[model samples]
Target: MPQTNDPFLEIRPYHDEEVPAAIERLVSDDEFISAILKYRFPKLSGSFRWLFKPLLKQYLRAKWSKIKTVRDVQMNVASYMQSMIKNTSEGFTTSGLEKLDPNQSYLFVSNHRDIAMDPAMVNWCLHTHGFDTVRIAIGDNLLKKPCATELMKLNKSFIVKRSVKGPREMMKALGQLSAYIKHSIDEKQSVWIAQKEGRAKDGNDKTDPAILKMFYVEGRREKIPFAEYIASLRIVPVTISYENDPCDAAKANELYRKQEDGAYEKGEFEDIESIVQGIVGQKRRIHVAFGDVIGNEFETPDALAVEIDRQIYKNYHLFPSNYIAAGEDHASITDTDRVLFDSKISSLPEGVAQIVKSMYAMPTAKKSDFPIKQ
Candidate 1:
């Protein structure tokens, strides 16, 4: 049930009017405070935070006292993002910004690589290139805690219903999602969503037709052709490539477990841990390429998906690490590149090493050797 008569109230990000209360609730939450202390000051928090909970609470309250709007939240965190980019990555490169019209809103569909970094990178690119930051689509699975939910919504991330059980509920959720996306674009707000539900652990990036179909679900209520509806949305395909994944070892282990057991179960805080690792870990180099918008030229979801996949693969920047994993002699790689890449995977166990190698290599194969589904 929504708190208001607005149809998207349940799933939409918090409004400007609600930012103050959401921040207050988040800072007051024990789970959030504990998570923050553990994330920011893990070494001393165990002994210090527990001993001085009141002091911690007072500090947080004063720090976040002026965060009364969504933009304020983004501005507050901008420095942290810039610092991470400065320290962790060699550099960030982007292409195709000149292709986009700044005044027009677009639906950016990108291949998911890292849980939080996928959208964060896209948003960063847009923000840096004089475009508005996009409203991100985040799954409900990551919003299990009240503090997590408030923080995400405050940062302009809307929830996607991933755990809906019944078919009817699933359909309803998708419909609402589709409607909200269309509404956002119509209102001149850009949106960022993954091409699939989860990150491609093995690095073979492909668009899921189900995700594309959801885009049409709400638009079909107007009795228009699917192609026309899709064209109206001005959908843009984006691809982001990381030279090195921060949670590569964890991702490899999970993939190996799935191969061995045919399924894998995740711990409750696994995603949060990955988020922390991704923020702090070394990425070496990063590239984001935006592709041309798919207009009335495509009629079916499969066709559209193939087109998106093609752009993603074609624009994916290959680093020395990718070629090294593929067992190719990199006559082009500098000495520093070789050393940095070697040190990244030097300590991995044999089995996980193979999985990590394949993860980096698959994108190259998809682009050159093997073709993704037609």
Candidate 2:
């Protein structure tokens, strides 16, 4: 077990020593077992749950029995992710991988789209290209259950305390988070975190300067310049573009409801629904672009955020569907592109349909307005 007094005990991922207990804990949870079976075999949910539960639980325990470390868990799930990508996406491609070195560690700041797949895609790209998988940053709010929490930690995901109360506790949490991120990189383990706290529901992908400020929280204690401290972390901006968002329709519905009501309330299971939708829905093509590390060039958090945004905007891959939906001339679009765009927006209500179009078109518009810097 980890030392009882460890400062990071509240937020860190499960250590190798704690993996066995986590596995056991997750497998024995009736809610988790039922959820997984229902997700994997929805047709068998109502009357067949009794028959499916024991078999599924046995299979899960057997699968997790040999997993005694984080890497073991990742290696086991690697094939499952590969299969998910193959089934859900038409094709997956990566760019700017040559700019990275396997021996070095980086803080990969990515634009978040899907709750689970954003970091999963980045990790898959690195692992397939002969690099170590990154430690993912996930929010505590997503861990609605103990089993869910254990599963994420077993997959090398550390929790970010989003629900902490009071300024003192918040500051303390951020300091510990900053220290943990720095320590991971120093140990040659890369880290993947979103540019902001939540997904850009409006399709605008901008880095929050507050996130950048948090990175300097611990570094400031060492009395280092902001630029030097950021440089030490080797921050890289990542851009992931999906030709068709797997949850575009769902996101549009949420956007419309939020607009209609002063405040939109989410059901307890809304995030879980989104997670499942993102994994199983069709994505035409997905592209991941890795930008060069932002070294000691930016002296301020705003400056750093701007540079990261620029990189993401410049590197974002725009599909023909994007152009078509943005109301570009249909004459220039190919037959396949026009057909794809038509089918996507045909069934939606007017408001939701417009939101979906804007979601896909925003990246194209942003890229067009900004010239790529050499």
Candidate 3:
């Protein structure tokens, strides 16, 4: 993993000048950067942090009162999001969130494009439509970073644990997540989760069947039908795009290195760097588009899964690469189109071919061509 503290981590408050140097050393170790961040900055524990409790609680209380009603919370959240996008990025443009159903809770399953913008834009879109906050699922491994965990919690994020090494542990974690989802929806709220555990590079955004299976734990020989359990909460598939995802080249490198080996070598610092780059890197257009909603009104998990996948893939905006890549065997676009694109690539500098191929992992020729459900 890339060390995030490569002089950049010094941006945050540092009690000592040596703090950055130590962070650099710690981030460079064999251990995951997350483990390092956790060890160095563990979550507030026991009574020692009580020193600041009064002050922190006061601020939180003030923030809470300032955001009393659901409407207040939504507006506040949108303003915060808007300010963030404006400060760090060029600007964001979203379409289709107005189509969201406010009366009923829906599962906002989306393709993971930009890390920060994906969830932020989705929540902002929903908020504009007067919907309640959506619970977001982020990896527990990520919470090890000092500031990030606090921010995620503030924004209604729940952890997705990756350290469940045994089936028993995994089942328990899955059950806990399921129950949390139930709690959120029962309260007439929505949840947004990536279609898969991680972002799809190479442009394939298929929902993992295992993820779908994990969502239906309550249906086996129990009081609820699997279909009803899912239908009870509406699942609205959404698609997001970044004209330029800052991490695109990094992602391509990771994917290529992973293909060469089995996985990419990354530590917790890589996540930190990714977070920072995502927030501060470039000026690009961000778009959040909503797709159709799929519900338990269906009869089975298998059917529901297929339907949801169809919906999500439909809304995916396949940029040029996804389009031209298909021309190899797809008759919709002429080979002339592929040759023309390749000719443009040929004019680029050295190693551009490799980079281009990696960058467009799943680049789409067209984003609007995904299938619409019957």
| Clashing residue pair totals per candidate (backbone < 3 A) | 0, 0, 19
User: RMSD to the native, candidate 1?
Assistant: 2.3
Tens-digit lDDT track for model 3 on 239-284? 7766556676677667667767888779757877786677666635
Model 1 per-residue lDDT tens digits across residues 1-374: 23678999989998888988888887789888888778777787467878766677899889889888778888876767899899999999999989998889999999998988888888888888888888999999998888889888998999999999998999999999999999999999999999998888888899999999999998788888989999999999999999989988999999999988999999999999998899899998999999898899889999999888888898888888888878787776777777876776678877888899899888768888435435
lDDT of each: 0.88, 0.90, 0.62
**lDDT of residue 211 for candidate 3:** 71
TM-scores of the candidates are 0.95, 0.97, 0.69
How far residue 23's Cα lies from its native spot in candidate 2, in Å, is 1.0
Between prediction 2 and prediction 3, which has the larger lDDT? 2
For each candidate, C-alpha RMSD in Å? Answer: 2.3, 1.5, 11.3
Candidate 2 runs further than 4 Å off: 45-47, 329-333
Scored against the true structure, residue 153 in model 1 reaches a CA lDDT of 94
Predicted model with the maximum lDDT: 2
* 10 residues in a row with least lDDT, candidate 1: 365-374
